[model samples]
Target: MSTAVTAGASGAPRRVPATVHRRRWAILGVLIFALLVVVLDNSILNVAMKTIASPAPIGLGASQSDLEWAINSYTLVFAGLLFTSGLLGDRLGRKKVLLAGMVVFGGGSLLSAVAGSPGQLITFRAVMGLGGALVMPATLAIIMNVFERDEQPKAIGVWAGAVGLAIAIGPITGGLLLQHFWWGSVFLVNLPIVLVALVGMVLLIPDSRDPNPGRLDPVGVLLSVIGLVLLIYGIIKGGQLADFTDPAAWGTVAGGLAVLAAFVLYERRAEHPALDVTWFRNPRFSASVAVIGLVFFALMGVTFFGAFYLQSVRGYSALKAGALLLPLAVAQMAFAPRARLVVDRYGVRATCAGGMALVALAFLGYLTLDTTTPIWVLEVIGFVMGTGMAHVMPPVTVTIMSALPREKAGSGSAINNTFRQVGGSLGVAVLGAMLSAAYRNGMSDHLSAVPPALRGPAGESIEATLGVARQLGPRGAALVDPAKESFVHAMHIVAGTSAGVILLGAVVALVLFPGRLPVPDAVGAQPEAEPEAAPAETA
Candidate 1:
């Protein structure tokens, strides 16, 4: 029941085959399955951060910045290649690109599983990100092609739900694997899922592509990759030293910004720009993307500190830490699919603003968390955060997707995800830096009792401090309470920063997102609104 698509430049549109139409739901299922693996790999890594930082036999002995790079490397590559991958999928045939992405992703996962050091893991994670860049846009683009406008909201809602669910549950899966197997098991776990996704892709999915695709713009792609890498590297380095005064810190960031600025100029002048910068001219499109970026910025930053808080400070096993994330997952799974109903009733501006408010409230809850804060309180925060996010993603995604023509679905999805990954990557780097600076400041006086030679390393993170304390025997035992207190204080600063960012997103949503009528017609929710989601031609 493969899909029969129109010719690349056909004048006549092809009717979707009845059989293919019937299997559209199944196709969506496989697409989400593929989506899960990409998300799971990262989410799983979050819980394993503590274990990964442990010495030699127990873990990779990675530093906090090493862990940050490990996460950012994947995100950078994913964000950098997303637009190009979207273009490639639109040009070279989506199913082919999807299959290739799966194979590459599987290989990356295997390599990461055998990674002997943080450097190797970081490199392999980038490889996985490449595959992800191909997989993500294709999934959404294909959904746009197969489903009718009326059905798109529902299908995309489920897709978005799966994304949140995968992110939420990834830690639990990682915890289970870490408890019984090894830290590498987190990466290894992806292999089987990739295998299943590959089989499904081969069996159910169909090939389709844009009739008139834009130029590949290899130069733009290269610039984006280099600029983002340089930027993230500088941020992580600044965090590592706990200072931006060093020339290496400010200089690199300056170079990255200059490169990015050059990339933008080149794009504006290019005959066929990789990213159509004009897309941002549409208030709805730009607003939605900005909100997405800010939300991710807050979420990713907070979650980075969350792993340490759950395991390093609370003394929870990886399994227990994973379990504690369940309320967030439950909230996402329960509300994501139904979020559209709220949008249909209350409109985009009000709904998203409301959701952002919930997210802000949740971040504030983190400030109250301490060495012995009740686990249920964290659960409540997770649920609130997840519920808010569920409402936000679907509406914004629908707007982004609907703004573009059906043939350009790949590019549309790329724009949506690019901001998302960029925001997340930056959030981790920036917040990770803040966390480091605050923790080091708090730990400085406390660390004088420790041997001078080890103080630098001990103040790097709670994991480092705890590991050092263990190595020091009785003398190190005295450092435990101080380390926990310092970490909690650092976490508080990050939590507050995250809350501020979320509020900014709320303001953006409230100000820039257009209002709509109470009821959406068969055509769209708000035809008169900015960046209307018009009914696209069926291929």
Candidate 2:
């Protein structure tokens, strides 16, 4: 029941064996499950990060910086190799690569679950990220390879919905597990799902490859990987390890961009390039990836920091914060499936651009948030942000996946997803750094008013100003107990900064995306290699 595709009278390849079309829906389901596993893993660990930092769990004596690294390490590798992984899948077979990716991911999860130290966990997480780089891109590429042009928008919409569901549910799921079990439980959860996906994929997924596979460009892969790593590292470290003014920070940023430029130049000349730089020449593909990155950058920032603000700042427990976020996820679930119809009727430009604008508006709401802000306000902001994401994610996904030739879908998915992982990592690192600085500065000032005798350690976590209050006890804690005004101000600063970043994404999306995507055939439809579904927004 497999299909063979050949170029049509118009020279665009079309799938044969019409029966394959009938199974498209089923194949899409398998890929969607695979996608859900990766997306859930991306954020599920956050609820348990504090426990992981505890000495009883890992005994690594973790710090704020280490916590940030624990999250970013996976994303760093995921973003760095995503594009190349997609190219490999396209040149190879989608099912073969996807199945292999699932095994690797499952193994990494097992390793992370059993890890005894922060270093071990971080290392295993990186391995998981490597697996993720492959899995994310392959999922999208497989969907593009299996489904027809007309059916693609709807399939992609479902895919986006699955991803959104994972994200929305990850926090509560992680919180519940953490509340009842060990920090390792979070990683262990990945095992059963991976096993299910593995068995299903082997039994149900079909093998697909590029009809005109190109030679692998080793130089292009090297440049792209190294360049992306450097760029992400620079952005993450900009405000923390060194300010943006630091030569090392700016140097890494400059060098990374230069390497990327060189990679693009090499790609243009290579007999068979890993990436088709020509894709950027098409505003449709370029804009799709850019908007995907922007949305995820902001989305990740809100979720990651919002979780911290709710639990650490507002004094809510992990389970409570997860419960509060339920509505935001509900909003995304409600809207994401419908995005396809909206896009199909209104076009990608309106859907994507409008989504970005909504996110920006939500961020504006976030800018005004504080410890005393009404809960309803945060809910409203969350709902608006979720709706905006629902609008943008599916259409951009369909646009990017459908625009490429069948063979090139892997690389395309990889590049888009890599940018997103990079953006998410940078968001956490960058915003985390900002929050850390403000906390320390404000803590130091507020403590200056305390008696020197009351400044002794009180056996509490010392990551931020909360450390001082916890150390001072009831009599000494009076200074900060009822209301840690300065600490509240610092948290407010972090939220405001994150909001500004989201608004910036809106500007970038509006500027880069053309008013309308061109008709399908206008872009060359030569059968080409595909990439993976590692884009940030899709996650």
Candidate 3:
């Protein structure tokens, strides 16, 4: 049962126990179990929002603004601290940080479940966000330490699959929990996952850190957290208002950008920088992160609208809509692990670009969607999109992690995640605004049926119009068809626009990603006793 492990993170190969290598996949599984709660929490909340907003005994009677803050607070806090948390993981130990994060997150989840007021829930959610920030980077960083270079992609694919699993089941899980229990049950669900993850981390994962971490860059860390908080908050606000020109949104965004610029400057001069800003100079690294941002931008924006399409336009319940998304998740689960094979055969550029092209095809399918489109067709389109993303994420992640030395995996993971979050934020803000404008334009004349007092709000969204219509009794019937039609039209317009962006990403991949992954020289002479030496045919 004894085996030698070559820890990937040290500047030198740190010889360790063979069990670290033998149970590497199990360690990854535990990490993914931990990640499942965090990643899916955002989407799972979508189903439970109305319940959370209900009056007491059922919910805390949260207002629209409170609800917005409840969500934004978590996202802003989580994004803001990612860089710092990653740095901490490097300076301290990945496993230690990971364990601490799980404890905090679990505590926050318990607090959130029992909250007496929306204010408490929001505050507790921020605590959860902080914990999530600490947890996310450490998982990937640990993966970098545990898996050898050739096997990283396969391990990462399994990691990515957990995200798809969360996506596939989050809404259904939330909806079911809400149906049988109090609104708090949605949050309480994290407990089991956290508990299992904690146990696994304790038993399976070994801590690893940067052997030569330099002096702490407190200034760089401060600047990064401050900038990301402001930037992400601004993006949320812009999406809410559906306009970036508003001083409240644009001003904060500009400030965030400026502070980030300053952080980069400070890091360049710092003897011990939190991150190597020069990584951006490498076209391979830069392009990989860029594609991550672009792909998520398209994915998140479209998915945001997709929920509305299912709920409001097609009149599906949250549970049913969530179930419809299952095919997408399944496709990612099936294909993400296999994407490396495609990359190995065709090279990074071809595989990535081809994936993006497939995503474009999915968007084109989106363009064909109608209020009356069959459920199976929606599932098929979703599967296609998921398949495309399965290919896109793993190779790009490999490229980014490969470019950085293993010891910097935490920072590298942070960079990858930061770009993804920001890109998704930009997508939701920009594409949401476009959808609003198009819907408003399509509803212009049809809105005459709405009461003068309700007309402005009715044009805002299908849900709003339907709310107004419900009050009008028999006369309100006139608004339903137009609202649905206008929304469908807007979805098509956005779908076409999203397709264009995905195609652009394909071009970026072709031009910038490394031409092909060179066959690792160790492929042929790998010793059987050494666990890290061989390609994992299956993770």
- The lDDT per prediction is 0.82, 0.73, 0.85
lDDT of each residue in 368-394, candidate 3, tens digit only = 788788888899999998999899988
- Residue 165, model 3: lDDT of 89
Better of 2 and 3 by lDDT: 3
Worst 10 residues of 1 by lDDT: 526-535
lDDT tens digits by residue: candidate 1, 111-164: 998999999999999999899988999899888877656567778889988987
In candidate 3, how many Å is residue 70 off?
A: 1.7
The per-prediction tally of clashing pairs is 0, 20, 1
Q: Mind giving the per-residue lDDT tens digits that candidate 2 earns over 1-539?
A: 22344444445555533444446787787787788888888668877777777787443466667777777788778888888888878778878889988999999999988887778888999999888888998898888877756566777777877877887678788888887878888999999999888888886677776757766678889999999988887776684563677877788888889999998889899988887788887767777777677667666765656775677657787777777776667777788878877776776676777787787788677666766788888889888888888888887887777667777788778877887777776666566666556655555544555566544322111234355565556744655542344445655675666666666656665676655555446244445333222122221
Candidate 2: list runs displaced more than 4 Å: 1-16, 57-61, 239-242, 438-444, 450-463, 475-539
Candidate 3 vs. true structure, TM-score: 0.94
TM-score for candidate 1: 0.88
In the predicted model 3, the residue pairs found to clash are: 3-18
Which prediction has more favorable lDDT, 1 or 2? Answer: 1
